[model samples]
Target: MSEEPPYVVSPTADSSSTARPATFIFLHGYGDDAEGLPLGLAQQFQFNNKMQYLKWVLPNAPHNHEAMARAWYVPKALPNAVKPRVPGHEGEEDAPDDEVGIMQSVDMLDQLVEQEIKNGTPSERIVVGGFSQGCAVSLVWGLTGRLKHQVAGVLCLSGYMPLQTRIQQLRNERGIKDDDKDPKRWFYVHGTMDMLVPTRLFVQGKDELAKWVDKENIEEHLYQGMGHSTNSAELRDMLAFFEKVIPE
Candidate 1:
């Protein structure tokens, strides 16, 4: 229903450098548009000198007429059941089951990566990141893009693993060996008070990921009194993570 561009780009701060720049692709949460928060942050925010070499791409999710929202994929119609449900937290959203639609969005993200590659950044220099629904899409794509290249890092903000139920099948389809580990570095940051994805879901996703990814390769940060949204401290830590993985 709304009209926004397909994507927004924030050029690197140090454009004077001739060497290939790193690219950080960001996807927005459900019902949100990239032209708003993501793009504005990308254009204005800088953590440290390490960010100077990072170019940003924030893409808008395709509109969903059924939900009347801009969503990466439609949320599951029914919430999932939790065993031994917590006393006050029995209700949680178990989303990211839309394989077909998630993959389609991955394909779309792949195009952005391909373009970045053509422009100069290699696959290893690219990072995939997102918030909430965007985070879910990025996770599935980072693991199963058709290009078959492991990206440098993934930034997950207040989100859970979408295809948690089908992770094994996804691994089999991608020819991933049980003992094989990926080159991608994962950084997961969540609010302890988050209600949307819930801390339990984060634990579930983290456990599932540890089966395939080494514990050393993943970093997690939990913020108290925070909700589904991000705050200054989380952003600072994220910048620190980027500095470690991809230096300017």
Candidate 2:
């Protein structure tokens, strides 16, 4: 069978001639197309015009399971029926190839960001973010691997690290000290009641991640009563966080 083409959502600014100051690349969760959550945020923020200075690109994940549904990779089925390892959860069987795919996504994103920069977007103004499975990939790529290009920050919503053991491997391979204080660059957002991924995973990941980086570099926000989805409050807080990290 021929390979399915990748997808990207391009929301342009009011003024087409001027280059945006930065770009935000959104990676969607499993079974979700690039048009959902990211598009919601792009509209909410009116990022195309309000932040006319910023360019928003939402890239759809590859089609899997013949549904044209998006996913970073084929997920490993889970043991507990209540906690199915379908799309969002990070289970052990998901280690090997998922890790590789996450890195590949980062590289691909880096290239896209570089192209934007060459077109007039600045490196320090770029941001990467996503929800659920998308968030998991963003977290792993932001923390473990080195970007060929630097971004302003990363936003990981309702997601957790996939492979915990790879922390040391990532550090050893990339030569990044656990305590290195460059700047607070990673943001973790989750609903306290999100049963899909569970808030506990974030706690666990953070505890382990602390061994390699300053806790300050990672900012966490818990939304009470929210589930595996994003609410208005979450979006507002996310926009606030973005302002702090990528101020014009």
| Candidate 2 structure quality by residue, lDDT tens digits, 109-172 | 6666667678776677878877887887776667654652267788889877776777678657
Best by lDDT: 1
C-alpha lDDT of candidate 2 relative to the true structure: 0.68
Instruction: Give the per-residue lDDT of model 1 (tens digit) for 199-223.
Output: 8777777787677677898898889
User: Could you tell me the lDDT of residue 37 within candidate 2?
Assistant: 75
How far is 223's C-alpha from truth in model 1 (Å)? 0.6
Clashing pairs in 2: 178-212, 178-213
Q: For candidate 1, what is the TM-score?
A: 0.84
